[model samples]
Target: MALVVKYIVDGYHDLMDNKSDPRVNDWFLMSSPFYTLGICLGYVYIVKVLGPKFMESRKPFELKTLLIFYNLFQVIFSSWLFYESCVAGWLTHYSYRCQPVDYSRTPLAMRMVRGCWWYYISKFTEFLDTFFFVLRKKYDHVSTLHVIHHGVMPMSVWFGVKFTPGGHSTFFGFLNTFVHIIMYSYYLLAALGPRYQRYLWWKKYLTAIQMVQFILVMVHAFQLLFIDCNYPKAFVWWIGMHAVMFYFLFSNFYKETYNRNQARKEAKAAAAKAAALNGKPQNGVHQNGVEKNGSQKIGICFTSQTALYEHSSNTNGVKSVTNGYTSEETKTLRNRAFVPNGN
Candidate 1:
């Protein structure tokens, strides 16, 4: 046990002393990995455990105003990061194919180092994405993928800032920052209220954009394998593998969320059409074999399978359903059921 402990300590010292970027060695949360790790672990504990327990007895907080500002702030912050990344390397001098880290004290190199450090800090700020969900008691939105993605980012970026602050690998951060600008803009609009929901139809495309980003990162990182580059191979594998992992994860989410929703819509349409052809009511047979009347029960049986429908009667003696929900409540329920939980 003592030997193992000593070996681990020695390795830690070696990496910190000899392998890390000297320019960023004294920065906040950069001197050691434990600081970042502790914050991430605390985030997991709160979101998965303490946070839920705390909200169990309380009514969910309606942070409408707060959310608007938070999302707007994120949009602005992300835009700045993307611009800095571009000016530091991607736009000015960094080669897309095989750019290596500039460890010198030159102005451009220092600017990249500063950009990488701010990017690391930005990951911690994103913990609020999950925190807001927990506070609002949107537990279903806090999925395993969401938690893992948020929990791992800071620690992953810490290494980037610690070792290779700039280079081909920073391309991932560059792309990611750009994606956030779009993503947070969506969230900001959503927080404004139901009136803005009509403008938010392209939510599914956000996931597609994220998936594309991972693919781009993978291509940029893996190309180094075929060509000779001065960059470290370890970082190449690390960044490339992370991109591959996240790409598949986002792909699965897209299929489950959007594709499944589309399939349900098609099935519902076919069922409605078949019922219309047979001149029978659209509702399914009751337990005692009675036919349901009116659109009140229409789509109830089909949409109930997905638990996405709500039935309500209007003052007029007529009944109607719209897009798997009542016409009166579609706006509210759509946002609740369909909005991506910052994944």
Candidate 2:
């Protein structure tokens, strides 16, 4: 155990010593991967293990006010991140196709580099999303996909900050932060409850927006391979691969949550309609087993003919119109009928 710790410490220092970008060397959590990995693992241990175990005998915490503030903070923070990214990457001397990381000490270049670090740090802050869920004991919300996404993002972004802080690749950060601004704003509104429900219908579209972001990132990254520029090919490939993975994940989620459920609902509605149409009271004059003119109170039921017509009047034995059973053959056919209860 001592040797393992020594090895890790030595490796962390060696990695830090190799850095060429002096601008990012002193930034928080940039010296080594260990700090970020430790925090991420600690987060997992708390939310997945310790937090749930502690809450076993207790009721879930509401954390309503905390969530509201947290989400609002995210909205503002992401807006700032996005704005900085745009001003640095788009408004400055950036080549959208194949911009390389700027190691210069110029003001615009430094702003872009700072924006990259901010985006990386933002991934750490997003862990609070899962933390809030754990505090609230919303275990079902802490899905495997959610964990993978949040867990992998910081480490990935860390490399972005450490290696290629600002380039064509940083565009991913810009697009992503833009999406998060909208996303966290939605979350903030949703946390406020019923008054915001009307505006929250677009909540379902959040996944769609995320999938679109991944698609855009993939497009932007793949364009690097076709052109000749200074941006690292390795980072471009990494970005493209990550984008595809996220796209697949989000698309699968969208299909399962929206498409399959919608299809099932439509199938159910069609079955109900078919059943209702077949049970129309003989002359097609009834609506949902009740007479259009409100004369009778027939209900759509599937029961034996004897049970249906036993209570009806057979004064002239001319067949019963009330229960829709005409003759012995029709009555014994065991077909669907509109039988009123206690009529």
Candidate 3:
């Protein structure tokens, strides 16, 4: 046991001495991985366990103003990160096909290092997203995907800053920062209230763009395997696999939320069309059903079918009129229903 412990400790120190970036060794949260890992674990515990329990008996806090400012800050911060990433490497000198880490103290290289550190710091601030959800009692938003994504990010990026601060793998951070810019902009508009809701019709597209980002990252990183790139193979595989994993996760979420709802709407329209062709009520109600103001009443026990017939006759068979449109007009409207593709 003693020999095993000594061997593990020796191996860890050797990796740190040989593989870690010495320039960031003295920087905040860079001295060791333990600090960042500890903070991440604490974040998960609070969001998943402690937060919900505390809010169980309490009223949700009104955070409209806070959310507005928070989202605004995120949008501006993400924009700055995107700009820095471009200026430091992507727009200026970095190659998309193959780029290796510049470990020297050159001006552009050090700028990339600083940008990477700030990106790492940004992950910690994102914990506020979950905290706000918990405080608002919006527990459904703190889903397994949300928690896992936020929880692992800090530590995952820590290695990049520690070993390869600026290289091919930084492309992931570049794309992610860009995505956050658009994402927080949406959130900022949403926090402004119902008037801004109209602009939020593109919410589903946000996920689509995110998926696109992952595919780009995957292609950029995985291509390093086939060609001779000066970048580290381990980091290449690491970054590419992360993209692959997230793409599938986001795709599943899209299918469940948007595709399923669309399928349900289509099914309802089909049923209504079938009913119309059969000379029955076309608006999802039975002919023998009692109708009040063109809507069917539930659980109203009529004494007999004759009573139901009498009620239908008095109401003129419920009129088949909805929102000033006749049954034929409503059918036309349904046929012309807008199935959104994109902006």
RMSD (Å) per prediction: 12.3, 7.9, 10.1
Task: Please give the lDDT score for candidate 2.
Answer: 0.80
lDDT of 1 at 38: 96
Sort by TM-score, best first.
1, 3, 2
Model 1, runs deviating above 4 Å: 284-343
List residue ranges in candidate 2 displaced over 4 A: 1-15, 278-343
Model 3: residues >4 Å from true position, as ranges? 275-343
What digit string (tens of lDDT, one per residue) describes model 3 on residues 284-329? 4546453334332432323343232232223321344333312233
For model 3 the TM-score comes to: 0.82
Q: Least lDDT summed over 10 consecutive residues: which range in candidate 3?
A: 334-343
Q: Which ten residues in a row have the lowest lDDT in candidate 1?
A: 334-343
Which of the two, 1 or 3, has more lDDT? 1
Tens digits of per-residue lDDT for model 2, 1-343: 9999999988877766764366788888987778888888887888889988888898888888988999999999999998898888765667767788888888988888888888888898999999888878889889877887898899888888887888888888888998999999999998998898899888779999999999999999999788898877888999999999989988888898899999999997886687667775434444444544354454444444346445444434344566454434433422245433332
lDDT of 1: 0.86
